[model samples]
Structure formats: structure tokens, C-alpha cells
Target: MASDGASNNERLLAAARDDNEDLLLDVFDQPGTFDINYQDGLGNTALHYAVLHTSYDVLDHILSHEECDVDPTNKLDKATPLHLAVEKEDPEDREYFVENLLEAGANYTIRNKHGETAEDLVKPGDEVILALFRKAQADADANMDDIAYEDDDDVASEGSD
Candidate 1:
């Protein structure tokens, strides 16, 4: 049973690393067979592998999982997948991943061992990535305001009773 679990984790990690979406989806579909956040020897989860390997398809599948932790950190560096995505050499790929990650609710404020948040890692003059981060922050702030307003209304209604 231990071997099975270990092998399943290896298979899942390999699928992410190789960008084999079909294999990844197959493994994920089997209930309780594999954890979505299964970490490798270096404590890098499947999400981290997807980002490092530039496997957007694998990433999308992982992000769609209800239990997915978008900001999972690698054990060795404490670097979240978002932090790794920011380090992509290709600007277009980097921007795409950043946008998708934010949309998938990746925490922009999560700092790595180096104390660098995803926003902090942005290269200077990269206005596009910076704008995407700002938009996510604005959206998050708006959501908090809405929640607070709803709570206030609920309190007032209870008081009126």
C-alpha cells in the first residue's frame, strides 16, 4: 500500500513534468488515488512541476480541482508556483501564467523564503504583469467590501427583530 501511494505520487509528478495532460487527468480522476498537492522529493507539488515545465494544460487541470492549493510552496526554497511562474524567461508565457494563476485565486502576497512575493519578483518595467497583479488586488478588495457590507446588513436585520 505504501509502495502504491509512492508510485502514484511519482506518476502524478512525472505527468506534470512531461505535460502529459491525459495521464494527469486520468490519475486525478481516480478518487483518493493521488493527492492533488502531492510533493516531490524537493517538496515541489504537482502545481510547481506544471509551472516549471511550462505545462499549462496540466496546471489547468490541477487548478480545477476543488482542493487545489494555488500557492503551494516548494520545501527547499519556500517558493510558491506563482513565484516560479514569475521567473519564466519568456515574457508572454510568464504573463499568461500570471494572469491564469491570479484568476485561479493564487495569492499574490505569499512571500517565499527570500521574502519576495509574486509582485516583488516582477522585473522592473514589466507593466503588464504589474497591471495584472493590481487588478487581482482590486478585485480582492472589492470582494472584501461586498462581504463586509453583507455582514453589516445581516447584523442590522437581526437587530431590527
Candidate 2:
């Protein structure tokens, strides 16, 4: 039974590397296929392979899984999927990936082996992506402030009672 699970996971990893979106979806939809965060020999989850292969469709499928770890780091560089997305060859694709990852709750503060966060990976010339990063940071700050305010309000009301 254990070997069966291992083989199934291997097949899933192969599908990921080949950009086989259909097979990936098929396998993931089945029962007891593999852990959503399963790591291959190189410490990469299926999502990491999808990003490495530039398979946006597969990336979407993996991300759609409720248990998927958006911040997984591979063995080579301890780089998350967002790190790879930031370096995509096409500017539009790079921005799209970055935004999607952010919306999915990707942590921009997680650093890689080089001690660089996803925001630090943005190229100097990619103005659009840079702007998106700034916006994400600002939004995050605003959300945190809102939560803090709510907490304070709760405390004040309790004290007044």
C-alpha cells in the first residue's frame, strides 16, 4: 500500500514536469492520489514544477486545491513559486503570475537561499510588476491596520461594560 502511494506520487510529479495539465487534473481529482503538498526528490511540490515549466494552466489547477501550499520552497534555492513567477520571461505573464500568487495569499516576505524575498526578485526594468508589488504591500498594510483597529475596539467595549 505504501509503495502504491509512492508510485502514484511519482506519476503526479512526472505529469507536472511535462506540463500535462489534463493528466494532472485527472490525478488530483481522484481519491488518495497524493498529498497536495507532496515534495519530489528535490523538495519541490507539484506547484513548484508547474511554475518551473511555465505551465500556467497546471499552476492554476494545483493552486485550486484547497490544501496547496502557495509558499513551498524547493531544495535547490529554497525559492517559492512566487520567486519563479517574478522572473518569468514575458512581462505580462510575470505580472499576472505575481498578482495571482498575491491574491492566493503568497507570502512576499519569505526569503530564499540568497536571502531575497519575492519582491526583491523583481527586475529593475519591470515597472509594471514593481508597481504591483508596491500596491500589494500597501494593501497588506491597510488590512493589518484594520484588524488592529477592530481588536482595539473590542477591547474598549469590553472595558466599558
| The candidate that achieves the highest TM-score relative to the unseen native structure | 1
State in Å the error of residue 120, model 1.
Answer: 1.0
Residues 6-35 of candidate 2 have per-residue lDDT tens digits of 565775776777777777766787868578
Cα lDDT tens digits, model 1, 19-125, are 88887877877879878888877989988988898987787888888988898888888999899988899999899888889999999998899888989999999
Q: All candidates' TM-scores? A: 0.93, 0.85
Model 2 error, position 79 (Å): 0.8
At residue 54, candidate 2 shows an lDDT of 72
